[model samples]
Target: MRKQLLGLAAVAALLTACGDTCDENKMVSGGFDNFPAPSASADGPTPGSAADFQKNVQDTVHFGFDRHDLTAEAKTALENQAEWLKKWGGVNLLIEGHCDERGTVEYNLALGEKRAHAAKHFLMSQGIDTSRLETVSYGKERPIDAGHTEEAHAKNRRDVSVVR
Candidate 1:
């Protein structure tokens, strides 16, 4: 009986020693959107593989309606791209500019060219070689998102950096 009691005490002590360390752990329960948010990272993943480049470095920088100027957010993304280019020196990129379906072909094509130039100039300012970069204006010919909604239009107005 004494041995059994001592074993019970030891078991209790062991359990107490393994007390909960998850006091700060939390689980959020809510209605989730169908689309998951992009995972935020400090420096993002390394820029060696194609998958890593797509995941970590943002390939596209969005612009406002009928605008070729880069936003602060676009600048930040381009800075990251510049860093990636410097890290992976062998990469030659094509900056493809696109636009929404609202404008005429000629106007949209001009806007797209301006957008591509804007992105290329920014990358060049960040020390990326102009020789390593090429620009193409898809205008409204190609779009990643096809919906006729504002969100889709926003996505359409972008300069995509493609590995060549």
Candidate 2:
């Protein structure tokens, strides 16, 4: 019984030593001192960044049901987007077309593609370079509003401009 008690005490001592050594090594090698403090910017997002574009200009346009045509409101949004793109010549854009969840997947994909092209063409006409704009269709897969309502559907049928 005494021999068993001594064995347990030795094991406890070894475990205590190992715990302290591990902690010390962790403090010396993986400490927060190795990381630099983050610098904060007061002027807001950097120019030509995605945040800047979204902040300074409208980046989305809603479409009517089953329509790929650009409404006057959509045209206005695209105009603003084109101006921002022109100002930030180095920034490229990805135009994502999303659809409401009423149609078949194949049909929605085609419609979404048309919607994307509609936005892209409008931007191109407003003097944004075609080379800087790419288009993609999300069909009914990525709705902004998941609820089954007209208002939600309207919000889901949209073209969003993303900085690339």
TM-scores for every candidate against the unseen true structure? 0.70, 0.76
Error of 2 at 33 (Å): 16
**Candidate 2 lDDT by residue in tens digits, 21-81:** 5665465666766654343136677777888888889899999999999999999999999
Global fold similarity of model 1 (TM-score): 0.70
The list of candidate 1 runs beyond 4 A from truth reads 1-47
Q: What do the candidate models score in CA lDDT, each in turn?
A: 0.89, 0.91
The whole-model C-alpha lDDT of candidate 1 against the native structure comes to 0.89
Best by lDDT: 2
**Model 2, residue pairs in steric clash:** none
Candidate 1 residue-wise lDDT, 61-117, digit = tens: 999999999999999999999999899899888999999988899999999999999
Where does the lowest 10-residue lDDT sum fall in candidate 1?
34-43
- Report the number of the highest-TM-score candidate: 2
